[model samples]
Target chain A: MNQKTALHAFDQAVALESVGTDTFCGRSPEAYANMVGPYGGIIAATLLNAALQHDERQGDPISMTVNFAGPVTDGGYQVVASARRTNRSTQHWFIELSQQGVVAATATVLLAVRRDTWGDTEVSMPHVPPFESIDRLDIGRYLTWVKNYDFRVVQGHFDPGGAIEDTGDSLTRLWVKDLPRRPLDYLSLMAISDCFFPRIFVRKQQRMPVGTVSLTTYFHADRDSLARQGDRPLLAEAHAQRYSQGYFDHTGKLWGEDGELLATTHQMVYFKD
Target chain B: MNQKTALHAFDQAVALESVGTDTFCGRSPEAYANMVGPYGGIIAATLLNAALQHDERQGDPISMTVNFAGPVTDGGYQVVASARRTNRSTQHWFIELSQQGVVAATATVLLAVRRDTWGDTEVSMPHVPPFESIDRLDIGRYLTWVKNYDFRVVQGHFDPGGAIEDTGDSLTRLWVKDLPRRPLDYLSLMAISDCFFPRIFVRKQQRMPVGTVSLTTYFHADRDSLARQGDRPLLAEAHAQRYSQGYFDHTGKLWGEDGELLATTHQMVYFKD
Candidate 1:
């Protein structure tokens, strides 16, 4: 029964709008704009959609940590989301967002109830080259949040259009989704774990002022493996482990087009030339 | 002047004790015991030493996330740590840690001020084979927090004691520090980023029922590279991406001894049989 229409602009930029008990609100529609606001993975999937429309949510979202701390001014804000510690199989959240009253972003989810234990992965899952052999990143006509998802890359290149090489390492790897397709829930895997690109623009070779101050995903699929990934296209990779002083520390993972391992993000960005 | 005796027991097990104005009061030191609480890296270095004795702390700690949310009963414990957003080059905290009043644990630091621009370190730092030719983890007389650090491994092996093999991945790497030594700061680099050893006991060998429910460090060195790493041994590694339905996600890094890149953790554990 998926029918919201007008191509679900990311379920209308992470819907929200509850307004009171534990607050909610969210806004920001120029179809996911971003260069300063809106689109830190739809503000971390609208603060995990205010803890997935909390009625004291308690099960699925194994971990999250946002903290963009400021910037997000394309209209309303508010959020809140509390559940501070429930325990039985686990639950704990904090969530903030604020605007006219200040705060501007902060999260800390944890929900749980997952069980059937004893599994394992231990990294390893980077072997791209499908997704119709690459070629989609038309930089979304100059980055308006890259036209709300649908990347493709398969390897580094945040702008390998003209000049800029030295890719010494901050890998990329892509293949995302939600551009006209919208199904893999948990708010589009928390906005594709903040859509990569900004490990100092895939490790030096130009591109100054960056952002992402703090993010941390973790999820690892559930909700029936995200409704058996209805919207497909997942892959993802990302790298970076220290860009020093002006900060840097990405680390993505995503996967799941059979390979599974749904999420593992991490961020700390904040660059400058 | 480093004199606190008993080799300062990991700096009095992450001292804290201020007691007011943004709270403080830590405790836990049965030499850092675990199996339930007290050594989640000394409760994440006493919540990053309550945001480093917040006087509105302003720089360093480039990211933190904590969130153990339950089990921390070894003694006193009250942390608070606020400064929600101080900006002007980053600063945002919101710790928790309670006890008799509940809460248990929660963090979110960010602090900044760093600058010196254009740096790099895209991962690669697992050369190992040094720390005086390995061999040191005696499992610390049955785990009282592995006798407070001094690990050494050089490659995977949480207990490879015998028939377990299958180490195809959950890599570990080691060479840690602080066993009667004490100079590096930022609360012993946030207690050596939770010291390692639980990538499901270094991949599938055995040792079920794990814990760590949420953690996320970032730090990338500063404070004169942690006072020139004065206590020595740093190199770390850690791995893990999916452990499935009962949580699991690691991602470590640490390094130093010239190769730099100081901190970059990430966690979300909680395993079972």
Candidate 2:
């Protein structure tokens, strides 16, 4: 197919085929592969896509929590999106992704029909240089998934040769957008929420075994706002609060070019020393 | 029952009786009633309690996301806790609370066996006066659930007669603990995570229709550390990031008396003007 008629890598990676009932069939595309398995962000987007494509879906997703239970092999899997309860204005969903009859990941999604109301933003976006003013750090050679996004770091970039004593704070601020230029949407926004590298690598200047245990994202922007965002880069900022008992948790915020807060995400990560 | 023999109000509220293989029965006690229904915190704690009390449970909860699907009536409900996947070090749970076969709330819990590792707390506890120095704000007459906790507000107290022009920022820092002095535990900590009043009320300083759509909590402390806390008050701080489309999301941090970060919580709230 011609480049103009071809599907974007992200679209292919998250593409799902309806099978039977509320189940769908999906595959982990090679374009978004990570060091161990598929990039987690793509997996998250795929699980959310299941609900978004379900026939019984009620409204837009306001909250989603995904638990990475086991490693997802690079192959096909089945996703079951079950709408457990549907209220007048809200709906609750229980979703599971299974491979060979064994569950690999699960998610809980909250969908609601939102209306315009009194609105305010208490947290302001961080001031940073334009995306063009920053330099993109190319680490795609190490992790294939890094090639999917163009990252312009303002702070907290990893120093491969630096020692522990030279490490800095866990704060990471950057401007990021899809490499092939995909417009912003709930699915893409969900994927971008997990795009931040594990905070431990930036804080200690050392890479250890770490994976996200549970991730929760709250969507602040609706469809119109997200569509207006277009393919422009988003200002993303994240930081860790506490690292204890072999675990660490970080919170992040994503903002539109016009300073609109798009989403706020939180994750609990498991780390091995 | 005598005072010494009776269960604490919190314990009684969270008490569960096994019904079936993976199901249990619970209640929404009057002690934790809110303006419209039961307190969201107790509902969350009770849901987590179902998993904690399960026979196949492993480790402690590292993350939990509770979706308040429908109004939970002030009566008995059945909770079904299903362990979807149990890996060597981590376990994933899907829990649901239903009354008369109708689902009311659902939760996804991540439990893991945590070990000691190199740790640090990037976010420090805010410097505030001791709990004894701040006068407690009593609003138990309006919301019965408020009486279940001792709230010593450091700032952002509601002014029942104040105008919107005199409203302050959407930040609330207070020291809170269960009433009647109950020791701290995972169950109690889960409930306290949602103890803060809605941020919209603090920002607008007006009483409006509002309810939490989803709540998530990340536990940073273990059983031992929680035991050491022993009924001491915890410094709780929460603030909103954005309020739009009839929904607002907030993040909170809970610190022990010694300034150790205990838990971090987030919630998405729905409001009607």
The per-model DockQ list reads: 0.30, 0.87
Local accuracy of candidate 2 as per-residue lDDT tens digits, B138-200: 664358888889999897766556634535478989999988899999999999999988898
- Candidate 2 scores a C-alpha RMSD against the true structure in Å of 1.8
Give the alpha carbon lDDT tens digit for every residue of A185-219 in model 1: 88789888889878776566566678898999989
Using TM-score as the measure, which candidate wins? 2
Q: DockQ for the candidate 1 complex?
A: 0.30
| Candidate 1, residue A97: lDDT | 87
- Residue B268, model 1: Cα distance from true site in angstroms: 17
Candidate 1 per-residue C-alpha lDDT over B138-164 given as tens digits, one digit per residue, 9 for 90 to 100: 874456887877888777776656556
